[model samples]
Target: MAVVLLLLKTVGVLGFISLLIFYLKKIRLYRAAAKFPGPPALPFIGNAHVFVGSTEDILNKIMELLDTYPSPLRFWLGSRLFFGVCEAEQLKIVFTSPKTIEKEDLYKFARPWLGTGLFTAPASKWRVHRKLILPTFNPRILESFVEVFAQQSEIMVRQMKVEIDGDEFDVFNYISLCTLDIICETAMGVTMKAQTEGDPTYVESAKRTFEIFYTRMFKVWLHPDIIFNNTRLGKDQRECIDYLHGLTNDVIKKKKLELTFDSPIIEDTKPRKAFLDLLMELSNEGKKFTDEELREEVDTMMIAGNDTTASVNSFVMLMLANFPEVQEKCYQELCTIYGANINTDTVITHEDLHRMEYLERTIKETLRLFPVGPVLVRYVSEDLDIGGHVLPRGSSVVIGILKMHRSEKYWKEPLKFDPDRFLPEEVAKRHAYCFVPFSAGPRNCIGVRYAMMAMKTLLATVLRHYILKKDRTVRIEDIKLKADVMLKPVEPISVKIERRKH
Candidate 1:
């Protein structure tokens, strides 16, 4: 009896010590976070309750918080500290600082799919892979992709003819499928025919996988691996990932086989290289990238390349549809380049893409207002000062790209969709960090030039062939947005297209 009592006392003492240590650490974090402004948080739970809602509701709540709180604002997700940094100056420090190079913890959810590809790789691994991949996206290499972009775009245009002179339909699906085809052809050297095939397993699996990732991110219950593994969502995600990984593996294997057999051929007579072709070449020579590494990087390229560009292109089309005047201007610019031959189906060349100064500005403006990455989350490795406030080390910093883009302090009528905001004189007036659609700093998107070229080529092709129209008068405020892996509308972005008159 005495021994039993002693054992119970011993267990109680250890438990007490553990509790005390946890509280002490918590107190330190609480004190550091107390310096910033935010909504009053509940103990233990902090502001976690606010995140439990539909994706659209979650986005609305975030926008509300952005409006209420000043820049360098604080909030907590369970025990983790988060600071919403929206001011351009504050964003500059968070982005450019060497100490803050790592992505936040939530990015780990993507590791299952991306597998430490450039998007989710550790800072050290990212540095090496980034250097290795940089040469593949050279301007000359990307210029070669214009033919594929224009070809895939023509397919999308032809498919949309079914909707011409008919009632409005969602244009986002058509744009996404077109982008998927482009990415598959350019990134994997495989013609996905996503537009022609109409929702293949690969495309469907990828779409569901992104939704699953975003769902897991906000739902705290799904954070634990053991619990999530037992759930239906987790099972579905696993199947999707397995299929995706298998597809990438098959592609890599086929390319390796082709390279092995084709080594005797001369370079000039060979086919134009895809990103995967370039990567495989490096892998074959000097044993650079492993089989796994190749898969990771290619999967990253497929998702990153297809999704962001598709979202921006869809929104740009929606914008043009809503604003007829802007559509007219864009069409006029295309006319000048194509020489008033509206019906002519000429392939968009790299030289032709550069002449699209006005269209480029329009795309930039769309990015500013509805950036596909509405928020960028980075980790603070050490105590970091943003403006005057110090973010405690290990805290997650959520850079509110949406808020920064629309801040009244920086933009004139911030919500207004004015492509003129990107005019040379107007651009020179604003802080560079205020308008980061591609993000900024050492980790800015590597695919910026590639994406711009693809979007311009695709948009130029479509505008040349059709006139965009919308059923209802639209405003920026009218579009209800949802926060997912990407920023998208709650409802489909619908528009009508008419065959352009010659």
Candidate 2:
């Protein structure tokens, strides 16, 4: 009885100490976050309760908060504090600041699927990898991929021919397949045949992986690996990641074999080197990347190269379908550029892509409405001042790109879908950081030029062949937005397609 009483007393003392540590940490967070305006946070839990619901609902809540709160607001997720910045001035500071370059802790969730690739790697590693890969995207090299983009787009145009029967269909899925095909060929130097073959094992696994990862991001209970790895979601995530890694590994092995036996002179004759070929060359020259590192980068490129361009292309088509005048303007521009060749089997030259100014504006406007990354998150390594608010070290800051793009202060008629908003004169008038579909500053998207080439090629090619028409029932406002790393329309974007008479 005396021993039992002693054990109980020890337990009581430990509990008291635990409570003391919790409150001490809370006090520190409260002191740092107190200066900023935010929703009231309860003890221990903070504002975690505010994040309940489906991903769509959660995004809506965030948008509402953006509308209600002033810039540089504090958001507490349990005991962790995150500063949300939406205004251009604040975003400039966050994006350009050297100290805030590391990705937020939330990105660790992707490590299982993407590995420590460029997206998930530390700033130091990312800087080195980024430099090594930069040469692969030089203008001359990108120009070589034009043929790949054109070929893939031609296949897409052919596929759309069967669907042009006055029935509306989801355009995003088809475009996604085409983009996947492009990435597979350009990044891995393999033909996935995603559009022609339907959903392959790798494609399906990737889709599931992303869906599960997004789900885990909201369900905090699953954040612990011990708990998550035992659940069905965890099991599925592991399986999907294995398949994805296997696919990338296979591609790497095949490329390495080709490099070993193939003659360098023959390789030199090729029109353009694939991204893998460049990496292999670097490896052969002693600037090596481990097999694991190569896999990580391949996965990163596959994800980055496919989704962002596909989303933009799909959104652009939706916009063109809804806005007939804008569509007509784009068609006219194509008519002028392609002229007699508009309806002919003509190749799109690099110069032709350069001449697509108006179509470029439409793409920019679509991005403003739905930037691929709705929020750009970064880890604050040191205490910093942002728009008059102090963000303590170890905190995370999220630049609300979607909010800033649509904010009334920067955009006139913020909700209106007007392509001319990106005209050179108009763009010059606005804050430079106000519209960053590809993000900005030192760590900006390395594939911006590549993405633009792919998007412009697909869009211009499609417009040349078909007239895009919106589903009669779908309105601009009816399309709900959801954030799953990338922002996407909740409902499939269905459009009626008609063959254009040359």
Candidate 3:
């Protein structure tokens, strides 16, 4: 009895001490965060309730917070301090700082699917992998991908004829599959033919995984592994990840067999070397990446490269449809580059892509209004100052890309969809960081050039074949957006297309 009582007393004392230390840390965090403006937080929850509704509701709440608070707005997610920085100057500080290179803890939710691929890898791993993969996106190499982009885009344009002259239909489904096909061919040196074959299992699994990840990101209860593993969503995520991994592994296996020690270089005769093939050549040259690492990168390319491009192209299509005059201008630009008879079969060369300056501006404008990545989360490794405010070390920062893009302070008549906003004169007048759909800094997206090239080629192809249209009644303001693995419309991006009457 004496021994049991003594153990209980010790345990009780330790628990008290732990709680005391936890509160002390929390109090300090509160003091540090109190310097910035944000919504009042409740104990323990700490503004978590703000993220508790449907993804659309959560987006609205976030936007509401951005509207109410000033730049470098402070908010807490549980005990973690999050500063929402939307102003260009503040964004520049967070993005360019070496201390903020690491991604925030929230990205861990994607690790089960993405592994430690470039998307979810730690700063140390990311630095090395990014360097290795950087050469693969060389302009010369990306130029070779023009053929693949044109071919896949032609397929997408042909596939969409079914929607011709019909009521508005969701274009994302078609666009996503097309991008999946393009990424698979370019990333893995294999053809997925996702568009021609309807939806593949890998495609379905990946989509489901993204949805699950978005759900887990906001639901705090799903953060713990033990608890999450026991739930249905967790089980579903496991199944999806397994399928995705299997597909990537199979591709890697076949490529490894084909790549022998004798021929370290893939023949120039091949239309183009896939990103995977380049990595394999490097591995063959002795800078070896494990089979698992190869899978991580290929999967990352598939998910990151495919989804963002698809979303941007889809949104651009919708925007073009809504503003017929903008669509006509883009078509006119395409005509100037590809000639008046530009049709579904027209091939877009790399030079042609560069010449479509107006189309490029339209794409940029769409990205500004509806960037696929609405927010980028970074971990502050050291104390940082922005706009006379201190963001303490160990806390996180949310670079509010969406809010910043739409902020009236940076953009005049911000809500208007004016491609002219990207004209050289206007762009030069604004701060450099004012528009960052691909993020900025040392850790900025490695695939920016690749993504832009793919988007331009795809858009040029589609526009050549069809005139995109949308209900003028459907204003941009009515488009409800949701936070997924990417930012997407709550409802599908519905638009109508008609065979171009030349």
Clashing pairs in 1: none
Q: lDDT at 229 for candidate 2?
A: 94
Model 3 is weakest, by summed lDDT over 10 consecutive residues, at: 260-269
Model 3 regions more than 4 Å off: 1-12, 261-268
For the record, the alpha-carbon RMSD of candidate 3 to the native fold, in angstroms, is: 2.0
Per-residue lDDT over 184-256 for candidate 2, one digit per residue giving the tens place of the 0 to 100 score:
9999889999898887576567767877777676566677899999999899999889888888899899888
Candidate 1, residues 195-242: lDDT per residue as tens digits? 988976776788788888887776777788999889998999999999
Q: List the residue pairs that clash in candidate 3.
A: none
Number of clashing pairs, model 2?
Answer: 0
- Identify the candidate with maximal TM-score: 2
Candidate number with greatest lDDT: 1
Model 2 scores worst on lDDT over the 10 consecutive residues at 470-479
Tens-place lDDT digits, model 3, residues 61-115: 7788888888878888777888888899989999999889899999999998788
- Off-target runs (Cα >4 Å) in candidate 1 are 1-13, 266-268
Candidate 3 achieves a global lDDT of: 0.87
TM-score of each: 0.96, 0.97, 0.95
lDDT of every model, 2 decimals: 0.88, 0.86, 0.87
